[model samples]
Target: MAQVLFLGGLGRSGTTLVERLLGEIPGVCALGEVVHLWQRDLRDDERCGCGERFSACEFWRQVGKTAFDGWDNVDVERVQALRDAVERTRHIPRLASAAKPAVDVLEYASYYARIYQAAAEVSGAKLVVDSSKHSALAHVLRAAGDIDLRVVHVVRDARGVAYSWTKRVARPESDGTDEMTRYSPGRSALLWNAHNAAFGLLARRGVPVRRIRYEEFLADPRAGLIRLADFAGITLQPTDLDFLRPGHADLGVGHSAAGNPMRFTVGRLPLRRDDAWVRSLPAAQRRLVGAVCGPMLRAYGYPLNPQETR
Candidate 1:
């Protein structure tokens, strides 16, 4: 069985950064957001972590050949539509107990499982880290029962997430183009609550899950990684967290399908908190986010008021 670590949470919660850090460890391959493989990477021809277009990259070419008969036989549009129909947030609860999943779910899971198997084979890693950040997909994979799936639910303060989503950050693609992603505070709060709740449902349904707060992980990454390794049934060596230099780690190439442009980042991962929102976010917007996410925020130990918390 392929040992898979599925990152489940809302986007911009440091999933990409954690994935990269975990990838630096020996015997682990971080495949960033394989959920976007059919749509963004293959159909849109996005750049891979290794700075090459998906079709042109030798590593992913092998993955395609190994996972599917060949890349040419895969219908990107059809698969993407199927994913939208079957794997969605609203459908997560039902899929969690879907002993006999819909044909679409089964088909997608088969294709996805092949990718995980191929990744483990090609990278020769004992574990494959998939930072897909989708609770629905996580539940589907768990129901499929084709691979050993473990989840690391990365959560961030909803206020911080709302602030992060409001900012316009550019994607670091090779083409010098930018992928601008922004969300209103209200939408961010709703998603933060809903995504976390969905993942919680999976845990209730007996999925092996480890919940990690982004702030706590940043406070002590070594400890956080130790807990994660323990949950995934892997042993961590001290050398894995030993930064070669300030902000630098000896990371290997991974053909992650899609994620923040940070996937293209190699070496020197600076660990610091992005607290700009506390200083720059407007008071009304902050309060609005607090109102929407306050109950869960407090449950996760985030004070409704940023001043009282961090």
Candidate 2:
């Protein structure tokens, strides 16, 4: 059976960083966010983590040939449409249900399995780390039962997440042309709560999940990685943690299809908390985010009171 470590959570919650660090381990391959493979990488010809356009990347070319016979049988448009239809917040319950899924769901699951299988084979790794950060996808994979799936549900403070999304950071592959994603505080808060709740629902439904708060992980990444590795049924050596040097991690190449542009970063990844939101974000927006995500934030051990911005 193929072992998969599925990283499911909201964007900008350090999923990419965790994936990168873990991928540094032997016998593990971090296949960025394969969720965006069809639409973003293949369709838009985005740069892979290896700095090659998806089509030009030798690794993905092999993955394509391995998964779907040279990418000819892979209908990017059809799969993209299928993904959008089946992988939505409202469809979480259905995706996780014991009832038989629709044919489209099965087809998509099969495609995803093939991708994971090929990734494992091509990388010669025992475990494939998929940092898709989509809970619905995790539910779909768990329901399919084709691969051994484990979940790492990463969470970050709502204020930090809200602040990250508000910035207009440019994509590294954009060549100064593309605009990064930015969401309103209200929208971010609503989605963050809903997304975290959906993952919790999956856990209640018996998905093998381990939750990790980004702040907690940042507090002590070595311990955080050990806990994550334990949950994923992997072992980590102290030397693996040695990837950290003064301010950042010494990273290597990764071929993640879609994620924060940090996927493209190689070597010296700074390890630091981004608490500027607490002091820099507008008080009204911070309060708005707190109000919107208050209950869920509290459930996840985040302070909702304005006075406790820490």
Candidate 3:
């Protein structure tokens, strides 16, 4: 079995930057956002950290065609359709946990083993990083016995994520229909709640998990990278970080907004905590978030207004 690591968190929680940083380490191949659910709509020019779409990129094309034994033949639309059919048949929240007889643990494990072999052959790295960042997928992957699995559960403050979401909603190029459709602060707050809650619950279940806060990772990338490398049993070199920059030049987007490759660029951006939600969200929206996600906010260390939630 190959060494496989998963990055789990909600969308827009700095998973891409973490994946890119990990990709720089020798013996690591970070497959960005390989969530099978979105494989159908994934376009060639779609701006992934890899700088291309999951389907059209030469790297992924090879991974699907050769490494994973012709996953390229699986037909993205067909897979997505099956998933959609499943979702249609059940409540949406249960989509993550639903068992699929078509793509059970063995099939998934075999497919990913092929990917690991492919990645190892291409990069000469012994470990593969799958930054799909989905909790349900992580659960499934862990159940697969073909790989040595470890998890890095990354978390960011709810308000910061909400602010970023608000910005994306305004961007003509952003694919944030959910954010646009549900323009309320509670959405972000609830997202924060759902992801962190998922992470915590998963971690508590005896999975091999290392919790990493985005703020802390930003403060000390080298140390963080070193710790992650140590956990994955890989050696790190300074040159690998610099050389990998060209491959990652267009890497940052969505969650990886602060894409500067230099390790010390963490402080280049301000660390405004709650202002994005406070300043940008209307009073009504703030109340909405407080009303809905307030209990979760407090449980996760965010203080709430006295009147909003009990």
Candidate 4:
């Protein structure tokens, strides 16, 4: 049985760091956001953050070849056929295993497994870390019963999430998926609130998860990594600490190395990504977040400032 580790949480919650650290573990391949089926095309506009056009990235190309080989010979049309089979069926991944030629969800899982397997062959990893960050997909994998999975429930303050959203909007190649609209500061705080709340409830029920705070990770990465390794049942190397350092000189080529989705480091200044929300947010924005997320902030250990309260 393959072991799958999911680094799931809101978009900017240090999932990349977790994925990178896990990748360092022998036999673990961290495929950062390789949600191949979700996107329309591999060559579509979105960058995989692997320093390559996703379709053309050599590593992913090999991943597509060896890992996704079964589908590789299927041609574009066959890939489409597989995709259409998914769309028509009510259960996206449920009937995946039953797809024509008997492609089950495990095969789908295996395709990614191949990617990790190949990466492991090259990088000497034993597990594959997937940072898709989708709760719905997590449920689907749980249903498939294909791999032993552990979910790292990473979280940061809502304001921090909002701040990260602001930075993304400023970038040229951003996904522009209306995350702000989905969870607009005040009114949409439900998106973040419910997301965090779900993790809390799951943890309380003993859902085999480990909670990691973005603040704490940045403050003392060594402690965070130690706890994370314990949860994943892996040991860390002394060199692992070097990878978490400021300049990111430790990460080798062919790795994301402190980039989006699959990178991490302890910054020299070491500030929380959400810190700017306090200084950068306008009164209206602050009011918006306060209305929906005031209680959530307090729950997450933030002090309540009366002016920002509902």
The lDDT leader among the candidates is 2
Off by over 4 Å in 3: 36-56, 68-72, 81-113, 169-183, 238-275, 283-310
- Which candidate, 1 or 3, has the higher lDDT? 1
- The residue-by-residue lDDT of candidate 2 on 123-234, one tens digit each, is 8988999999988887778756678888889999988999999999888877878878899989998889988888898888777889999988877887787888788887
Query: How does candidate 4 fare on TM-score?
Result: 0.71
Question: Which 10-residue window of candidate 3 scores lowest in summed lDDT?
Answer: 255-264
Ranking by TM-score: 2, 1, 4, 3
Worst window of 10 by summed lDDT in candidate 1? 243-252
Q: What lDDT tens digits, residue by residue, belong to model 1 across residues 7-88?
A: 9899989999889888877888889999988877777888899988888998888888888868888888788877888889
lDDT of each: 0.84, 0.85, 0.57, 0.56
- The reply for model 2, stretches above 4 Å from the true place, is 306-309
lDDT minimum window of 10 residues, candidate 4: 264-273
Q: What tens digits encode model 4's per-residue C-alpha lDDT throughout 1-310?
A: 4566777777766777667655655546677765443352353434444554555556655655665463345344544454444322245234324334234444444444445455555545656677866553453344344466777888876666765665633221245443222344653465677566655544443347777777777666667777877777777677655655552324443343123633423223232333666777676776677667878787766655633422
Per-residue lDDT value at 176 in model 1: 54
Q: What root-mean-square deviation over C-alphas does model 4 reach?
A: 6.0
lDDT of 3: 0.57
Clashes of 1: 2
TM-score of 2: 0.96
Please, what's the RMSD in Å of model 1?
1.7
